[model samples]
Target: MRAINAIRMGGVDVLPLVEGGKGVSISNGLSAGNWALAGGVGTFSAVNADSFDVNGRAIPQVYHGRTRRERHEELVSYAIQGALTQARRAWEVTGGKGRIHANILWEMGAAERIITEVLEQAKGLIHGITCGAGMPYRLSDIAARFNVYYYPIISSARAFNALWKRAYSKTAELLGGVVYEDPWLAGGHNGLSNGEDPLRPEDPLPRVMALRKVMRDFGLHETPIIMAGGVWCLEEWESWIDNPDLGPVAFQFGTRPLLTQESPIGNAWKQRLLTLKEGDVFLNRFSPTGFYSSAVSNGFLAELRERSERQVAFTTETIGEHVAEYGVGPRKRIVYLTYADRERALAWERQGFTDALRTPDSTLIFVTPEKAREILEDQTACMGCLSSCRFSNWAQHEPDYTNGKKADPRSFCIQKTLQDIAHESDEPAAVERNLMFSGHNAYRFGKDPFYSSGFIPTVKQLMERLLTGR
Candidate 1:
């Protein structure tokens, strides 16, 4: 294995390994700070990070506002406070040892305001900002305002090209290394575009090389490319070391860091990672952000799959091959469906999926009455977590504050599920019932000898093991 060396990144020399930021308090100050102290870049999630009370207990993010817009304001305030708290903690723990970066989802509600507030309050504590989950065209400007570096996480070279052309070109100096997150392998919200097929996973080497080529074309030769997703041991990536074509490169580990002692995830969630098997992680398009994400194939995901499977398209009136008329909801709204689809819908209804919920599209999905009620309640209690949510049809805009479409039944409230899973109690079953984001290589936790007998490592130990190439 090639010897790991320190690289200059974010205006400092540090180890090439990076801790990928996980949200909803999974990757907090302790984990990120420890990784930074280990001479690597540590990225703490600033997307609604947990803030503590006077007694050092986590303060639950509760909203008292009745309207979605008001609740969104509350959420932004909480986010800013939480990010500042985490940044202060990370700075204290790192003791000015290495770089500390904050991660934010661009699709998050009031992203610019939250980031600006945090940076203003926590100035100098956070060295860089890493953003993903959408086209962050304004990220560079925001980072430059604070004189900090910005890393835009992109899945393809084309995405970076668009970002550079549209906005990043103005603030080229603050363009910290670009992060090429593998859409097929990364956890949480993925960047799989309409052109890509999720089933066929491509090799990261070629894709990353393509990204490097794009960077070189833009005269970004000295800038490093951070390779995230599906990265495990350094030995496997020995060939990428000192490769002139790829230039300075680094690796970001998201799933591997979850089992570390410093990780903020609950004990049940940590233990669950060691029991996963091959194909246990699934990539599905169920996020309210309208993007594909990878998560554990638990009961939560299974229920969503089943709900989508019971769907049937409908027409307002009788059309060709849509002769059967069906009544949905208590009002008995009439719609036309194909004869075969009518039979399927009837069968689903007879099997206890009595309530039919309309989606944003011209389709109806069947679910149990209880499930339908739960979905309605969740939608009603929407706090506008995302910039535009497909599940609740809540947009951050002031005038309308709606997506101008019906709320989608196939998707659930992501904010609620992520918070529940991350802060769930000791019950493993309850934790499994919530969305558990994980990378495709999460099964390796069970297979790797390093974690044999359910042994978990500290952040420093994991970094050492990774540097040794196993």
Candidate 2:
């Protein structure tokens, strides 16, 4: 195995290993700080991070606002305070050892405002900002304003080129690095574009090389390209090390860190990771952000798959093969469906999935009455977590504050599920019911002999093991 060497990143020399930030308190201060203390870059998730009370107890984020707009304001306030708290905690643990970066989603609600507030309050503690889930063209500007390095996460060379040409070129000196997250392999929200197929996984070498070419064209030869997703053993990536084609490279691990002792996830979640098979992790486009994400194919995901599978197209006026008439909702609004589809829909309705919810694509999905009520309640209680949500039809814009479409029932509230999963006690039931974001390589925990006895390593131990290319 090639010896791991320190590299200059974020204006400092450190090991080119980064702990990828997971949101909703999955990767907290302790985990990230410990990684930084191990002489590597640590990224704490700033997206709805947790805050503590005076007694050092976790403060529950219970919303009391009646309107979605008011709740969104409350959420933003909580997020800023939480980010500051996490940043302070991480800084205290780091002891000024290595670089500390704050991670945020570009498509998150009030992303710019939340990031600005966090940076303002926790100025010196955070050395860099890493953003993903969208084309964060304004990230460079934000980092420049705060005088910190910026890393924009992209999946393709085209995305990086677009950001560079539009805004990144102006803040060239502050360009710390470019994170090329593998869309098909990464956890959480993926950056897979419309042109890309999720079923087909591409080799990262060619993609990273293309990204390096783009960076070199922009006079950023020295800047490192942080490779994220599908990265497990460094021994396998020995060829990538010191390769001139992809200069100054780093690896970001998101799933591997979740098994560490400092990981904020519950014990049940940790145990679940050790038992997963290769095909357990699934990549799907069920996210409210309208982006592809990878997660465990648990009962939660299976339910969504079933709901989508039971869907059929409908039209207001009969046309072509849409000859059968069907009624939807309490109003019994007439819609046309095919004779075969009508029979299928009737079968589903008889099976207690009587409520047919219309989707944005002119399709009706059947759900149980109880599930329908829960979906409505969740939508009603939306605090606008995302910039725009397909499930709740909530947009951050002020005038309308709506996506101008019916709330799709196929998707659920991400903020609600993440908060529940993160804060829930060490219970398998709770963990299995929510979205469990994980990288495709997560199944390796079961196959790896190191964790055969269900042994969970601390952040330091994990870093040491990774450094040895084990």
Candidate 3:
């Protein structure tokens, strides 16, 4: 396979390939740098990125403070430092060929602040920024200040158009491209909206064309649409190449990139990825962030599925206002429920549904005590760096979402577990406790002769295989 020519992305000639940013430690500076070195775009995840250490040893960042605002500030500061560190590391690894991009979630309370500080601190090292998980109307403006290109990951043309109409218009000049991340197949948080039914998956071609039409409508015909999620070997997607229906197209790889040698993920996680089988990927709303995500149906995810199955909607007000004793306390006793729900819950418990427990915020329900205990221990063993977690409500500093409330138990403390997994910590004892994001096609590795060791390839090798179709 001949090497593909570089495409213009945010004013830089970059390989069409993009390293989709994975949070925690999935796609950090090392991985992104390698991607850029390979002549592709690398997106370093700045969300909960590690900032510093006490004596050159990495420090755990937990918001032990008293208020939400205080906790948010600490998180913002740490992210800023983390972003800078990752950028410099990437620059060193890439030797300056690849453009380093930062990926951030849009809904962070201090998103704008963190981004500003990151770009300011990273300076020229960071060349572009990619944001998703929510409509990032302000992304263009944020990227503009640094003269960096901006890419907004979206699932549909309608969502893109809405952003353009409401806020992105002003930053259109600096808009590098749009990332059409396939909601159903991509790892991490999906962009699926309430109006969109999960069961009804729309065809990608039509949606791509619609996006192209929107670009044309906005006079952005020259802008490329970076197709993400479910993209494997080009052989599987040759029909879309140079096809007018999906104009100015480029493909982005999320899960596929993890197999690369240069990928920043831990070796164990990578090995786990190689063994996945078809139909093993699942999409569910297990993230405390309140977003639906796609991941492997491993022990962790299976438990969540089981817990959901046991769920029977219960109301606070009984038939008219009936109070029920759901837990052992007054607070638990105050819960209202219908007879049917009570019967169903009791039945589920009798049938072994005793694993259910409240989320950290107490607003949602999760698996029973066994798993909840596992998750809590996982939380307490904090490597510490999520902005606001539901599991432990552990912030980086004090005054955390302290609203005088404990972190919701419904939401797992992402910082604690992800850091542990990334660092290969043995404290958790169970890899299945954390969510593992992967694509639906992650099973391809098992059949590939090149991956016999379960030895994951470096980013360079992975990119070569992708570009060469071998």
Relative to the unseen true structure, what is the C-alpha lDDT of residue 5 in candidate 2, on a scale of 0 to 100? 99
Minimal lDDT window, size 10, model 3: 357-366
**Tens-digit lDDT string for candidate 3 (295-363):** 777777776666655554444455573445454222454555556666766776686545445433323
Q: Which residue ranges in model 3 land beyond 4 Å of their true spot?
A: 1-3, 52-58, 313-340, 343-409, 425-429
Residue 233 lDDT (model 1)? 87
Please provide, for model 1 over 262-338, each residue's C-alpha lDDT reduced to its tens digit, 9 standing for 90 to 100: 88888898888999999999999999998999999999999999999999999998989988999988998899999
Q: Give me the displacement of residue 235 in model 1, in angstroms.
A: 0.6
For candidate 2, the clash count comes to 0
Every model's Cα RMSD, please?
Answer: 1.0, 0.9, 4.0
**Residue 447 in candidate 1 has what lDDT?**
96
lDDT of 2 by residue, 399-464 (tens): 999998889899999999999889883899987799999999999999998787999999999999
Better of 1 and 3 by TM-score: 1
| TM-score, structure 3 vs. true | 0.86
**273 Cα displacement, candidate 2 (Å):** 0.1
Q: What is the lDDT for 58 in model 1?
A: 87
User: Stretches of candidate 2 above 4 Å error?
Assistant: none
Clashes of each: 0, 0, 36
lDDT of each: 0.92, 0.93, 0.73
